[model samples]
Target: MWNYNFYIYITTNPTKTVLYVGVTNDLSRRIQEHTENKGNKNSFAGKYYCHNLIYYEHFNDINYAIEREKEIKKWSRKKKNLLIESFNPDWRFLNNEINQE
Candidate 1:
């Protein structure tokens, strides 16, 4: 049997004013890319500076992670806020934490 890691994550700006939902197999690398892509006006995540990880969920199946990302992307901002708050009430940036663990 084989197992793989996939992540559906939510990241926000430093001000916590914007949200970006995405799925990736390498969470740390993905976050790094996001950080590097910051200030890239062509990218939604980059343009908004939504690189502060606030919440994430892991999955063994990539399909499930993609599905969850799409579902979250369709929700209203208010709904998304509630979802993030439920998992990360303080909306703390988790980029450093992920790497430390």
Candidate 2:
């Protein structure tokens, strides 16, 4: 059996005014879907231009990924920004990082 890694990701707009959190087993594809606006407009990410990935955490367990996503969604903007800064000080779009890898 193949094991897929799961991810809890946070994406923001170019100005970093909007934030969207989600969990997915296929991080790359999910990010692509968000950028393509393939998700429903009712979604926070889809409603806003929150396709620039700013931070992400990987997990082998789906439940853990979901739990982390929930926790992140509940965080205040400041807290979220801090989390992103810890890993991405410049808040660079992670799409390029993904593509490079």
Best by TM-score: 1
Off by over 4 Å in 1: none
Query: Each prediction's Cα lDDT score?
Result: 0.94, 0.86
User: Please, what are the lDDT tens digits per residue for candidate 2 over residues 25-79?
Assistant: 8888888888888345777787787889989999988989998999988999999
RMSD in order of candidates: 0.8, 2.1
Clashing pairs in 1: none
> What TM-score, computed on C-alpha atoms, does each candidate reach?
0.96, 0.89
Task: Name every residue pair that clashes in candidate 2.
Answer: none
lDDT: which candidate is best? 1
Per-candidate total of colliding backbone pairs: 0, 0
List the candidate 2 regions with Cα displacement exceeding 4 Å.
Answer: 38-40
